[model samples]
Target: MLREIYLSTALLAAFGLVGAGLVALVHMGTAERIEANREAATLARLHEILPDGEYDNDIINDTTVLSHALLGGGQHLVYRARRNDEPVAAVFTVIARGGYSGDIHLLVGVRENGQVAGVRVISHRETPGLGDDIEASRSDWILGFDNLALDDPPMERWAVQRDGGIFDQFTGATITPRAVVRAVRDTLIYFDTHREQVFTPIPVDPTDEEAHADE
Candidate 1:
């Protein structure tokens, strides 16, 4: 009986180790491809936001922080677009949490002058026909936010058409579109307010160097 228990335990351990090894091998093989795909996608989105010229990579601080200008949700990735060593605009990922089903990720570009250059939906799990209209494929409604400035007597001009503003919401899907509009508006406002801080260079901490060395 003792011998049988020992054999059973050994087999379970061996199986567990094999499973872990397979998972590790798969991850190791796929890591590069996954990273390449991510980089390509990021560059494509950055180009859409800043179509004029090339941009160099700029890192934000270590702490993941969201902008208050975000309306429906928050800011994710922030990149500073540059031309001739001068910062032209800051592109950041914004999310709209009030989508028909859930959060809708959006890539937003705000110029130094506080105008929205462009926006693109990165990903979402919204309903097929109804909420999908937020995508560029279903409709060109999302493109309407391009070149909108945050000036004038009031920024209320950026609201949805149903709210007596410039943008138009989907026929039946008002909440999804409305949330996106608000998010874009808020992002622009946040950019205008935190222009200096966002454009500043991120300082590298010495502790990070030690951590990397340990790795």
Candidate 2:
């Protein structure tokens, strides 16, 4: 009876190992394809904010992760665009933390000359009709950021009109648009302060290279 019990335990252990190996194999087999699909989706969105013809490089892969208070205090991805090897623009995925409901995610594109190329709301929890107008589909308000600069409206006047600024706020949902304006301005400031680092290539980890080689 003890021998039977021991054999049963061994068999169960073997099965567990086999199951884990199969999962790992499946993940390894599909990992590259999964990554490719994610990259494709991100590239499509990036093109929406910054035209594909504006830059010649592979903007999707030309990215770096950064964190700063001006960028909502957590790691955010930054994509760089170049024309003839010269910096053209940088797109930042910024988070607006003062939204009426919660955080609002934004993709802000700023050119090398400091003008805003474009801005898009990736996600938001603002009110349906009022705050939701910040979206391009809901309204063209987000497009007003194009060609704007910190000095264009003056740093002090970057808030919504209700706050004595240039941009207009939603009639019933002031917090949502206000948060987005602040976040975009903050992203521009971040880009201005970190231009060199923003365009610099991310260093490759030796371990990562070795792992790829092994694969």
Candidate 3:
């Protein structure tokens, strides 16, 4: 009886090790493919926010990470676009954490002129019928953000109508829209103040970036 138990335990451990090894092998084999697929998906989303012809550089590879309180206090990726060796716009992935259900991720493209190139919701867990209206497929409400800037909306009016802003709030949902508006507003502000930093070339280093002053 005791011998039987030991045998079963030994078999289980051996199987577990084999399973782990298999998983490791599969991960190693598919790692690059998985990463490529992810990059393709991200590029698709980026194109939605800032379509082709908007810039003449590889936006995907021209990126830098930004960590700012205005951007939800988390590390976020900023993709820069340039044309003829001059920066055109900066695309940011910002988070709206006051959504009705949970955090809402947004990809916002702000032109060098301070105008918004476009905005797209990357992900969210808001109510399907109400808060979800922020999505392009669900409704064109988000389209209202195109060409917008801090001055366009007037900084003071960067909130849902219910909150005395020019933006319209959903019939039954205000929290979601309000959250999105605030996040977009903050993102624009950050980009405006840190335009050079936001559009820093790929693999930005703090001391190296400050060298812009000499150049």
**Candidate with the larger lDDT of 2 and 3:** 2
> Which candidate comes out best when scored by lDDT?
2
Candidate 2 off by > 4 Å: 1-30, 204-215
- TM-scores for all candidates? 0.74, 0.81, 0.81
Q: TM-score for model 1?
A: 0.74
Question: Scored by CA lDDT, what does every candidate get?
Answer: 0.75, 0.92, 0.90
Q: To one decimal, what is the Cα RMSD in angstroms of model 1 from the true structure?
A: 4.7
Model 1 worst lDDT window (10 residues): 56-65
lDDT of 2 by residue, 2-119 (tens): 9999999999999999999999999987998899899898998898888899999989888889999999998998999998989999999999999999999999999998899999
Output the worst ten-in-a-row residue range by lDDT, candidate 2. Answer: 194-203
Report how far off residue 29 is in candidate 3 (Å). Answer: 4.1
Worst 10 residues of 3 by lDDT: 196-205
Q: Give lDDT for model 3.
A: 0.90
